[model samples]
Target chain A: MGIVSPGFSGRRRSGSELPPGQYLTRDFPVLSAGPTPHIRTEHWEFTVTTETGEATKWDWAALLALPADEITKDIHCVTRWSKLETNWKGVSLDTLLADVETSADYALVHSYGGYTTNVPMDDLLDGQAWIAYEYDGEPIDPEHGGPARLLVPHLYFWKSAKWVRGLVLSDNQDLGFWETAGYHEYGDPWKEQRYAGD
Target chain B: MTTDASYLDGNAAAGALSQVFAMDVTAAITQCNGCGQTGVFAESHVYVNAPGLVARCSGCDGVLLRVVTTPSDVYLDLRGLTYLRLPNP
Candidate 1:
């Protein structure tokens, strides 16, 4: 668990304790600060375009039918405590990205919240990422990011964007959210990459 | 009855609540048992015991303590309906 120290600047309360590293907030008010990301059914599509001549797309309905798996793990928050038990159900990122033969070396994950994170193709194929829809044995609530959220448990919690909408295959990694705000681009809980300096 | 009346009358009513008393309450620096974040509010305040209180910080989603017991230096969690005594004015 992360220890809350006094004068953590304005980012934390004067005497507030933070959860462990890697776990995202499941609490209130924290999720209520931002604008609700837009969700469009008609315009929504998960597309995978390769360097080749063809591209494949999966609509919302088509996605729900895929083989789903529930992952149980502990998550650490950048503020610092570790949430011991959490569960999420969703399609494997590898399985979803399997059909697309992208010669592009990297990929960009795009979300409805106006956020994006770039990861290498090798990382995507490694099987540690997914599009999560269920949390803690229940359908994800809107405030905690319902419909679908990206879970990259291996990285810091921030990498797992809430209300994720799409993934854009790209040749390079782009910074997202806290990454631009002094947080490490590739957050590693073990490495203590909670803030810019770690 | 006369003795009781005289005893009661010895104490005057606080004039229209217009007087102010300077009071200082100290909050302890503690950590949330759940999240492990530091600086959570204690389980007691100046004159109350707050068990199972929870508060989040604005900056980093950390848990924080809302009040403390000054005399005993006890930390109280600031959850539920704990009340704070205002300074007398």
Candidate 2:
């Protein structure tokens, strides 16, 4: 409710966006733990591994062979910024998982340069997510997780991991980077779940 | 805001940090406890586009300050700074 940080202030949130306690931002700000890894398209690959260790992988060309859809959706970040109507193009999870079989209930998305985030398997299926390679009509910038990234628009944007490489399906919901760092396990902006206790 | 660097300095967060601090904390001189590198707060690496804002020492990549602001509470930790002397007068 107030600022207690060393010489720090806070931003107020107002407006009926997709989430509570979030402000609207037009500019797409770049966020990263270290640096933006430049993954060459030719060397890029996407994979889906089941709990039993069976995996289906697709390189750049193979991924493009799948049907690509243009998607426009609103994305909310737990950091308190809601960027609405972000346009993306990629293969939907439904298309990607149509042939794959698995009984796992969770998915841990891994990215290049060692970044990871977990999402409920249900949140990823039934056309809920995509392996988005394009943003706003251009190949995603490396700084914004370009080449390819997860596009789980419903949850907090962190679930849409940048520089996404592949996924490892599991029965257990292993906490990812932020989740292990006290961020809410399931970050649903509507519920105002930004922290662990909340 | 280019592909050249994935991160930006402390200036980008001035607006959000302004809500609580009357003065610009980015102008403060902070010495990192890890590497003993001293610089203006504005020169530190600020990862602001996340669930929270984490300012790290550009010298040794040590976390200088961590901030997470929820609807009902504000959490700030400055354990990485040996001393943070703000300018006034």
Candidate 3:
């Protein structure tokens, strides 16, 4: 809230629409931690694994066959870029979990590239999230987490793990790939909780 | 392409690094503390996709540098490097 200092001096900001210190990047920047895994839609599957190890799976076609919703939302990244009014289409998690059973209170979202992030189980339900496969009316690009990515717009974009392959329900919370390194456990952008202590 | 599509050389970090160092930090020679491999900072395997910018040693894949810029903070970690010698520019 102080006058723009040295660290943030490099980036531009308007503050009216963005969460805290974020800047609006017209171009969606690709920030990846590892090599991209080439996954075919035919080979893509999403699994929901409970703490008891019970699993329910859905293949690409089956997923598309389920009810889908068109969404327009803003996404904020921990690295400080926010894209607004992005459109996405995907099946709601409420519908996906309708048939699945779980007593766990936490969920650890995992991506195909070995990336994992944790969130409260409640965050995935009641219209809070989706397994988004389409962006801007087109099939989402593989590099953008296509086949599908978990879209949890309320949290930082990283929590919406790209190449999302599964959600592991847990009775206990666990720190994921970035969380273990220092990212906030529950990345609420409005609160500006970007790091461990923040 | 999203920055996620590829890993770039450390030179890609210039604009971001400019926030901290007055000179071009990517031109400095660095030695990895983990594997002891030495190279110009530009040659490190730099992954720009993530919560931050992560540069890893080309030799052993140890993290050579990590830069995370928040709204009000900039975290630069060189723990993976034993030393960095700035080239006379």
Candidate 4:
């Protein structure tokens, strides 16, 4: 008969198995606005404005009524925990941008909790990004950022801002919260952009 | 030379609570002065010699605590009994 449990495995099994390295948790207070010129989505609307001036605005209910798709992927946090097989459902950013006609050179992704990330027009238009509304097959909990969030799976988790509300096509790229706080501007998980230098 | 009296709700160590979001250890023990009793604080944790701050007591809701760094551990006295942030294992 084959042995059930291996004695020489030398692996500690438990319900809570932490990922490699120490995980540090910070009590980050959510900020809703910044000194820079920006718009707040709580009172404002996400208007898909075009260079030709045709535009359509989406409110909370109208935004939720859009199509939803499920995705499973690994998420690498800037704090260094790479969670595998996370599932989320939301509208694709590519589909949203397709509805707009933009000649702007760049775009700024605006989010609640007073966060913003900049992307080149080409970069924004190329990725498999989504505005996630559900997590793990249910409505995302408030603590995990409810209402809506931006999921940029290609980059570190911090780039996936919580309570995300709008996207503004601009002619320039601006840095967001962690980006201004010594975090890498382009947080690519493949390159291990966990910090400014690493 | 210290008494081992404890509180019911860990009120003395009220300033040493740490939030256990994922796998963190929360509600560490602390010494209380009021009731002359101490108990396990459920909300506080301490950071030893971190940049800009010496120690933080999450039990007291992000209050700064006294720093007494030793070779083995960082000792923080909540009321009278010491709360130690042990070295990472």
Candidate 5:
């Protein structure tokens, strides 16, 4: 039998504070696939490209000028770590997608390091996500996806692309890097969908 | 937790693989069976979000190694690599 580590209870929480097969973490872990791309604020830009290839662009100042919100929510990682009551500040995806009209059902999120992930259109709208730039009242560190990252608290944290650059709308679902390599297409931590077959 | 697109390079796997191997495997040169490419293990893309650690060839994205840890065993699969040359420490 495996011995439990000290002060680490494997018991599940009563409320939604914790998800299945997940452990609460006080320290935010740094996870990335490649080297951290240091993007200057002046060079920072966000785009939303439609299926037809029409693109909407937003510079750093333009994004910061928009109405922003400070969100406090729980975040779950597919790696089985859950951070509760995390604070973030960012402009809502709703605000960014407000002017753009799209009937596409899937979103292929692109990051600066050439990383990509797919998310549902519904997950990016209706105040469900944000282009977060700050964490805990401080500018997010580069290792943690500073400048901006897509924050989708509902799905696994991986779906929240770090160093996010743009979103490409697609009529069909397109698997991103990890998804192509055997990760679950739709990562739902609640269901423990960590791998392709899961 | 591993994310769908979040991945680290083989450098991240050094710490984990060290537990099983006597030498630092990340510095080892591995030949990709799929692409015939040779490079340091640290250059391979490492995915830790899944049930195990998967290292893929950067040249071809072909899986070079996989390490799965269970309650009583650590399963390692290196069939994707043609050969792994580790330096003597």
Candidate 6:
């Protein structure tokens, strides 16, 4: 006699498919802490600033001009919902950071409406992350982080900042908004690292 | 105060808070102690990415409520808010 939500399929995956304390959801729930900031594509810009203050910027057209890749990945949120096989199209972070040379170890991501998050520089390089603008072959809705959002599927969804605008390379680690407020500095969903302690 | 990318407003916490609070907590008006600003809880910033659900003052980014749920107990801290005016049911 387990309580199930209205549309829950009652289907269970093998132990390896889902992480501990997580449930699979067919719907992609929209969760945001504040009002959705509507940014026009014409007014959008993405910047990458180095520790020394050197910054390189890409406008909306410039960003779209870059080579894009189609990615299908599983995303797990700390709130206990895991959505698998999500599709997205975007420019890889590797392509964005390629020309920029830096010895920094951390990346502080900034969003359009003043939101910020920090991630290890290594985690965003290689084929690990991207600045996604399209979902399921359509332009992403503003409510779901439109113009472009950081997509890092390896860690918890929170590590993937929404409405991303810039990335600041830092030599030392600094906690972002949630990190300073007691969320785990590194949100690894597989280990259930939801809070600072565990 | 710096904005958090991993957070949503108080309205987002209504679903989680409903487990403890019977009524709609988002519609409740709250006064912040730090800035003495009054606003609906639905507009306050909420960070659910952590172990607990934290609702912050939209005016000053102060923690207005913190709810932590463990296996045995649910702890709620509302020290940052001077008062919360709940609607009559």
Best by lDDT: 3
Which model, 4 or 6, shows the larger lDDT? 6
Off by over 4 Å in 6: A1-16, B1-89
Best-fitting candidate, scored by DockQ: 3
User: TM-score, each model?
Assistant: 0.55, 0.71, 0.73, 0.52, 0.72, 0.73
Q: DockQ of all candidates, in order?
A: 0.01, 0.18, 0.23, 0.02, 0.11, 0.11
lDDT of the candidates, in the order given: 0.51, 0.81, 0.84, 0.51, 0.83, 0.82
Clash-forming residue pairs, model 2: A9-B20, A10-B20
Model 2 lDDT per residue over A42-122, tens place? 989899999999999999999889988788777888767888777889989989988888999999999886668999999
> Candidate order by lDDT, highest to lowest?
3, 5, 6, 2, 1, 4
Tens digits of lDDT, candidate 4, A107-167 = 5666553456755566555545777878888886544556677777767766776666676
lDDT (Cα, tens digit) per residue for candidate 3, span A81-145: 99877789998999999988788999999888667899898888988899999999998887788
- Give the worst 10-residue stretch by lDDT in candidate 5 chain B: B1-10
**Chain A TM-score relative to the true structure, per candidate:** 0.75, 0.91, 0.91, 0.70, 0.91, 0.91
Model 1 agreement with the true structure over A1-198: per-residue lDDT tens digits: 335321112332221233333333454223222334445545556666554536678777887888776676555555454554467888887789776667777666666645566556666566577788888778776656666877777665556767776666656666654454345666677777655555
Candidate 3: the clashing residue pairs are A30-B3, A30-B4, A31-B49, A31-B50, A32-B49
Supply the TM-score for candidate 4.
0.52
Per-model C-alpha RMSD: 18.2, 10.5, 9.3, 15.3, 9.5, 9.1
* Of 4 and 5, the candidate ranking higher by TM-score: 5
Query: In model 3, which regions exceed 4 Å deviation?
Result: A1-15, B1-5, B9-44, B55-89
> What i-RMS does each candidate reach, in Å?
21.5, 4.4, 5.2, 17.3, 8.5, 6.7
Share of native interface contacts recovered by each model: 0.00, 0.31, 0.43, 0.00, 0.08, 0.04
